[model samples]
Target: MGKILITPRGYAKYGDEAGKRLEELGYELNVNRSGLPLSREQFVESAKEATGIIVGVDECDEALLKQCKDLKAIVKFGVGVDNIDLDAAKALDISVGRCVGTNSNAVAEYTIGLMFAASRHIVAAGCDVRSGGWKKPTGVELYGKTVGIIGFGNIGKHVARIANGIGMKVLVYDVFDIKQEDLDTYNAKSTNVEDIIVNSDFITLHVPLNDETKNMISTKEFRQMKKSACVINAARGGVVDEKALYEALKNGDIFASASDVFTSEPPERTDWVNELIAMDNFILTPHIGSRSEESEINTVNKATDIMIELLENHD
Candidate 1:
């Protein structure tokens, strides 16, 4: 039996039953154990004999795909497929499947959590408390604040619904047109990106990463935002420029910012990420927007099922 390569660090740990099911199907599993995403060399070595792969953030570019003659299918463990070279996979007749909306609610909830955390200075307050200092920092209320959501997709829609439930006015910005009925359902108003940038009290990004969206929020956009505005990005890394974000925070161009993704995962300590990490107003998370127990299990199991189905069909 050919092998299946599983590259997600949290796969079996979060979805152990699914892993056992795959093993019972007689496919040899090559699980990644390094805790970090596999390097190109490591991926090539591990996947050369694999008929299917369920990947996390590993790069599966054209060059890598060309070398994997045995690979028949690739399943994205989460919503984003930017890491995989779709054109190369299609050219090679390899099936690609992604678990869409598997983590939408989880990411939405996390985005809202970031909003409250940043607005209330929760992290700073906790730190002060730990140091035996007593102080009540003034914080903005989410109620009646304007929340701008970029990308009216599954995650964005959820965020809007939650924001509305909390009495926040929702403004949505997306390139594609959204139906008025849908907008009315959430009490959201469709607006342009420029309007959202300048008018929103809390701006949250939910767009995918692509040529059009890379650095979508940079120096110019930051400059347009109000000084009291807070920006939250739980979307893909590189969507918000880390360097620009650092400068904006340092210079008080904006009130504060929170990011769950960065240009580099587990970012190196020497870069602009290091400087951003030291800022009191800047909050960062280790891309755990979709790490909720329910989301993790759903994504892993769904990816596993897709890989198994594709592998079986390829035979």
Candidate 2:
């Protein structure tokens, strides 16, 4: 029987049906029972004996890939493969794939929810109610507001559609070409990042983490935004500089911000992160952007299919 190492607790929580399919294929699964990502030592040790790995946001670097002698595939449980070293895997002859479009709607919807949460102070107000306070915080409506979307991929497109549905004007930016017809369909205009940062009442990010996008939103970008602008990031954490974000919130450069992704998962509780957490204008979620019940199961099934295909076709 072949061995497959599975990380990502969310998958394990919702993967019983998918799991049975893998078992039927004669693959013995070694899933991470710990709710946390596997530590480097644990990953290398366990992955060394496995023919394939189903991974989440955990780092899969060249060094780890070199040590996993039996590995033939690294199938991403989600769309972005930023956490995995694609070039290293290719050079090492390990097939790598992602469950594309599996979680786009879930994440896009979460992005819209974050925008609402920030614009309406929904989370902070809820906290106050639970803490025995009844102060009604005045919040802004999303209608008739201008929303700027960075990275016009699947998630971004979904966000644009939702924003349009709510009577918001959409401005989009992408490094690649965005067809003008598609923009017209969403009632969105193709624009530059600077225009988005300066003019948008709400700015949302849905880009991959790469050389061009790392720290894409920083001190300068925050300064360029309207003082009442709310920023949302449901994309990779590194795309927005946390330090700059803290400063922006502290100095009132921006009215409010929310993130579902952080540079560090479950953030390390650094002084900046702690301060951001304490501020009423900031919101943080534990990376549940693509974690709706429906999406998780969909991701697991697609990831399973990829793993099966790779293992069966491997020479």
Candidate 3:
């Protein structure tokens, strides 16, 4: 029975059912109790002897993976693996897996919430009321507005369903071809990125972070967007350049924007994130896209099952 490193703080916070199950199956649990992502040194030291790892947002770069001599597998608690070095994992003969679709609905629902919060200035209005001021903010209606979706995956499809229910006109784009049936199902139109960028009333991103998608929306895309448009990034952070986003919001290139993900987690006080946090037109959440009770149970259980299978049933 080898050790399994559980590095997500959320896992520990969600109670110890997964850990208890692992223990009953005779696998040693090395759980992170720090209530936050482990520092790099702490992560490497703990994972060096682990047979498998259940990770969240913690980075598992090539250099870090090479030091884990006893590591056999890395199973992501969520779908994204941008923090993990897949090439290095392959070279090291390590198996990698993810809890796919476990958080799709949760994240999709969150994206919609962010859209309403940004479009209507809900958060800002609440803050003003808390501070003993009464100010009504003018907002746009979502009904009958064109919403551009940048990716057409599970989460993207879920978003489209919700948007359609709200009477929104949906325009979708993806690197791969979107089936005509899916377009018909959602009453969406298949379009290119430029059409979405320039013409959409609301633009939402749902792509992963990779070489091809990094900074996919930057200064030029921001400049091309309608002055009344609102941008939403419930997906990855690197897909939109932070510096350019800061400038866009400051100059009112877009009416408002919101994001649940950032280039850095727990962004430093000295970072541009702090500036964005101060703006009434910019809404930032602490990466809580998939934090619903249902999603947490599904993702943690799936991740634990994968770890057990990899460690106990591997040939």
What TM-score would each prediction reach against the true structure?
A: 0.94, 0.95, 0.95
* CA lDDT scores, all candidates in order: 0.91, 0.91, 0.91
Output the worst ten-in-a-row residue range by lDDT, candidate 3.
264-273
Candidate 2: tens digits of C-alpha lDDT, residues 61-171: 998899888899999999889889999999999999899888999999999999999999999999999999987999999999999999898889999999999999999
List clashing residue pairs in candidate 2. none
Best by lDDT: 2
Candidate number that wins on TM-score, 2 or 3: 2
lDDT of 1 by residue, 179-212 (tens): 9998989899999999999999999999989999
For model 3, which pairs clash? none
Task: Show model 2 residue runs off by greater than 4 Å.
Answer: 34-36
Better of 1 and 3 by TM-score: 3
Model 3, CA-based lDDT: 0.91
Candidate 1 clashes between residue pairs 3 or more apart in a chain or in different chains: none
Model 3 ranges off by over 4 Å: 271-273, 312-315
Top TM-score model: 2
